[model samples]
Target: MRTSKTFSIQFWMDTKKSKKSEGLIYARINVDQKRLSISLKRKLAIKQWDSKNQKHLGASQTAKEFNRYLDLSKSKLFRCYQELRDNGEEVTSKAIKNLFLNEESNGYTLHELINYHSIKIENTHAIGSIRNFKVTEGYIARFLKKKRIDDISLSKLNFEFLCDFENFLNAYYPKGHPKAMSHNTVTKHIQRLRKIVTLAYNLEWIKDDPFRRWKSTFDKVDREFLSDSELARLATHHFKIDRLDRVRDLFVFSSYTGIAFVDIRNLTNQNVWIGDDNGNKWITTTRQKTNCKVKIPLLFRAEKILNKYDGHPVTEISETLLPKITNEKANLYLKEIAAEVGIQKNLTFHMARHTFATTVALSNGMPIETVSKILGHTKITTTQIYARVMDHKIKSDMDAVQKRLNEKARKFEEESELKNLREKIVEAEKTKYANLTKEQLIEKLNEVLNEKSDTN
Candidate 1:
């Protein structure tokens, strides 16, 4: 039997149950997206095994001797593989593992790890985030089917598997989506895969990080937000459809308060607060995405919307601060709202947060730190992303400086021209008199001095 180029041999430790000092080493044989593992029956100190170099770390006698044993085991495995091939026997990881271990098998499968991870994180993560992972799982299942693969052993999932998955995502045009997945969108799927693989590595189910050499690249996206005029129009415009009005009000509330759609959906009256002075109103909640605490002073417009829906049927029934609706439908109605208001940008519920950052807050000179706090961002850099997209802010910042510079430069040029003109006029007076008698020169000089300046 012939061996495939995808075949590889690696040594890793069973560190999950090991004491801090040492761990038992195992050999993994990989071929064609499958893996078979067998213990090398050697224990090495945790610090001695350099995972990256796949060998011992230092030049000491013990390290040298241990690495020599690892090298000898590798050569023995290679000999077994060569013997199998020369004998015209089937060459597979399982076949080689059987010869090496002379016994039973134990390895984590891809789906097994995913199922474990899913069950493990089901309680901690948000439903939307869990659902998104499930959607990625579906894509993975589809990819495996397309490649005629039943399942991959987690230890055998290499860089090439990720590359194929990325290619699949790039070409995937699911129903109702406008086009194939975008660059950043494709990166997102692989990102999910990386998370899963990283979890397995951390759990000691795998030895080396399959993604060690892989790097994900993302394209910068220009997010859309409403202009002041469009926002005002959308805020004030009355829609004939009642559902459109509710969606618009919620969107406008988010635009005013900068709350995310999921967090907005989960708001309640308890989230609203009044100052001890009993004058100021506020909305306080934890961000669903970041789990960071948020406290926003309610603006007049946002408070009005809240009051308008107070004790209303939908809010009362749903036990929320406002009418409840799916994000899908809210975004759908936002399209209608955009067309009614004559705005050209493709609107999404998240853009309301962008509008708050760019048009409402940053454009109006609100400090980014305050905006970052109100938005429940853990890092100031996260808020800076919204700040970076404010083209209007950029234009306004440069406007006065550019205008002042241009005016000063023009004034200097005029002064220089005026000085040159005066010098030329004096020269002309001197030359005109040089060709004349003394009396004519004096008369011409007097006449020229008396004449009004035509340069004016």
Candidate 2:
């Protein structure tokens, strides 16, 4: 037996009969002291009725649904109902029905649902995944700690919360950073929230989904990649101190290799290999971030750099390829290098990967597919960011093409003028030859010829 009301629930009742039937558990719900119960067959017929009020309780289907509703409204069946009844003002059935209809019967008040889903994900996924979920869940908990889950209605998740949380993340832990949390980071948080909310809907935790009106903050994020000129400046810049200079070189090297700092720290001479058939040396490694293997051809500059450090004993000294330095010290030196090279953009260790993708590969006219493979990007779309930045290179290429066309046009004009001069010279020779007539030449030339012959 079952009952239905503003909320729906399922209850398990112990039965005396050895053979259990559909109506083994008789569900009862009190509506102003009126008890409603439906047998197994009746509960089945109205199982789909989301909500049936006192007015609609006349029909048999509605009556059974009402009883099932009552069954679900039991003390244990209703989650967070006590809080709602205590703190919330008397809400009309129509208002509650509106909430149910708004979410399309997903069941609103999603705190429990979010937590439950987070727990499941934590159990089944990686430690990093669980950590990220807990972080997002912490944000949600702090945001709605005072309010009941049901009170976190669709309208409450406005733009204010989004902006406020962004500011919060900016001030989180670190008291002052030059900038707030990155748009991509904040967007990830929002995405996690969306995932949990979606899970809640599927699990029937909340009746209304608040995320329908929500939009991603991803597009508006300031995800910057270093330019080729900026990268070149870092590579060629002269640092005052040897320590800073070596840091710059190593960072630039890692950028060219497209490997993260952690993986770069693990690099050894063994990781470098010369191709057998082609006889070309390349760095064969995998990215720590994506765990994808990458094989990047050794540029001449890269080979030269390695040759300089090849004989150096691997130690924590500046001579080593990867001189052991803390991330903070490494980044500090990188900032100085950027400043010395007249690069206005903020420099960081991670930017090296972007620099390699944008400068060493895409800017050099290498195909994006090839670049993506070199960078070990899981998806081509991740590599498409370089394509967007490559527009400036496209413009520069157009300028080169125009310059070539102009040079060719000038050469063609000069050739045409030379041909005209040659034609004129030929015509002049023909006119000069035609001027001497044969008869006059024979009579007049006889005396001259005799004189010339005698002189000869």
Candidate 3:
């Protein structure tokens, strides 16, 4: 149950709109009942045009060539229509017009694809994802300029082009950035490029995938988090400065709840509610990064922090659960707090999330499946990357193994004692058999054979 489509093209001139002696040539396209027109950017005098045949009425070489060009344009338009239809794209007059103009609907360019992707994900993807697309687009524009290329066609994307682009990225750095691009950063750009390329291929804008041979990988990085003692120190140490105290409270809250900075900053009273299990308070909200729902039960410490900030002037005005502060200022204050408290770890808001996953959750005998759910991770592997194994976990595992080994050794000793008893019994039977005379042994054997035959 699909509608059939029809396409037709014609050459014409708008005599009423023409202000010059020669009228401008145009190609008119009709798709089903819809119509559209594209200017050929050429002009022909009324006397030179053949109205009946839609050709120039002349024998001059210039006239013949112009007629041939018109025929070629018509043929190309038909081919574009057929290709689009075969690719299962809805054939519209505007789509055909864009194809003729080398726009994104047909012959997609790198810049056009980037813009399209940016617009497409504006509402659907995270802010970080959108920013990455914009940054990638800027880098691509610079790369093209450095190579003296106007624009790259989707068909021309290959391994060689990717290598050149990678080289360009290594040498290129954005303005105001402190350092050159790293391998992982360059790899991310290539990943975004691959995503766009895959989209183009799915849409039939490109026949071959250029990234088929390209390999992308990221180096593992060690992330820092607080230990249980360090977290307790931060919680107990009182600061004279009010701002530092507030930042400490916020960081500690995140460490206990496993919430990121953006999600924590946007938390409201509505997100906190009494759970059915023992009426414990819980935070029910959606993670901004993955849009996954996270329901974390607020521990005593996290609840106390919230209670301390309840009904504050800033919180009341903002209708949020906590006072709002810029992330930059929070990190700056964290460094000062860390220095004052003698904690050497580079303290950041995000590190609190890592701490929650490691020290507060996994290190305390929490299941990784539950931790992954609490952290709003789409996969358990992602949580594993975030959670680091502490020395205590290893020691606990080895302790369990040693206990199992002791139990196994005890069982083996008991089995060996039983085995010795059975051997003694066998020796006593052998002595009894050896004491029997040959005639008595032969009589016993004959009697056992007769009993076995009767049972069979």
Candidate 4:
């Protein structure tokens, strides 16, 4: 069986300083082949040493932290190799490096893999996932600089390391930013890292998948949709009366259609079909996201918008149904419209997709499964968020039911009043019978009973 080599990065405090004395500095680097690892050691500030206080002034008390760092790198590497060897694979430092350096693994070093795998999803896997992966990559690099793609080891990836990175992200991120990553963001990076590491293992690059049991830390996001009041406000919002207006209208159109921006950009006159086959005029098209064809009974408003924009001049001479607007400009216009409508939420191209899912589709009592297909979500869970927003519809139905019950009660009260009046008239007639001595009490009682029954 093969074995991994052991190494350590040592830190030492320097006592001598040639300049104005500051706190002592320490430095570290790994060495294994009997060569001295060189680094500039931090100098202790003898001038600031407090004999009475028994502490070094102007020095960060990070001796324990520095020691932990040294232990972490060595221990993580050893544990990673042990995991591989336990899994019935020969393990050595060279073998580990060779596995990590394989070009098929995206030329990631061991350190890169450890750090990269710490994140759940990576941008390299797909085009749409790039934005998030780029953010994750930047965060890791900012905290841990210049990590070679091949130097990652398991010991470097314990729970503490993951937590520390998350803390670092939260602390360093600027205040009041909506897109600032959460714990779940950290988890996604880790998950992606795990997936890539698993690939490496299958390729015999590493002996074991250390992240196989790792879990994520993000709570479910409350997917919000526009309320009726918000939608009404949006409809009346006056967008900038220019090309930006065109972009806004297209975005609104997509919200109603539940088409993603990518799909909308690719749309053309050919994609729209009027089906007389169903004995009614319906706009039929397939969503590019899910490749699912949908036939929506055309609303007059939707049809009007479509016709107004039909065959609009495209300067680019492309077959796109709408004039091409860059995503950045579109987003800017959306934010402007959102502000005009008093929507405090940050508006994006993707928000239009969510608006369609909740406002245009699910709130109208559409089945979630159908909505999912319309939105082209790969999972039912993706569609489930709309179900949560449908709570208001359930409340509306309950209110309608209560209104009906109240109306029924009012009608019953009116009938009861008439019955009481008829009873009183029969009693008056009986009282008059005593004076006349001809009208019978039995006839009065029968009249009253008949009147009450008729009223009922």
The local distance difference test score of each candidate is: 0.85, 0.64, 0.88, 0.61
Ordered by TM-score, highest first, the candidates read 3, 1, 2, 4
Model 2 CA deviation exceeding 4 Å by range: 1-138, 141-174, 178-188, 219-233, 236-242, 307-321, 388-392, 399-456
Tens digits of per-residue lDDT for model 2, 1-456 = 122235433333323442323224433433334444422212322333333332113567756665655554444323333333555644333333343234433344446566678678755665557788888878767656533343465434545766665566545553366666666777898888888777765654444456777777565434456777777767777677888876786777876777777767766776788866888888888775566888877877677767767766544354435556777888888777777788787888878777777767777777889878887788999887645456788899899999999999999999999999999999997776577889966776797789999999
Model 1 lDDT-worst window of ten:
98-107
Candidate 4 per-residue lDDT over residues 211-263, each given as its tens digit: 65556666878766676677657655676576656776776677777777777
Model 3 regions lying over 4 Å from their true place: 1-106, 173-178, 418-456
Against the true structure, candidate 4 has what lDDT? 0.61
What lDDT is reached at residue 153 by model 1? 76
- Local lDDT at 422 for model 1: 100
lDDT of 3: 0.88
Instruction: Give the number of the best model, judged by lDDT.
Output: 3
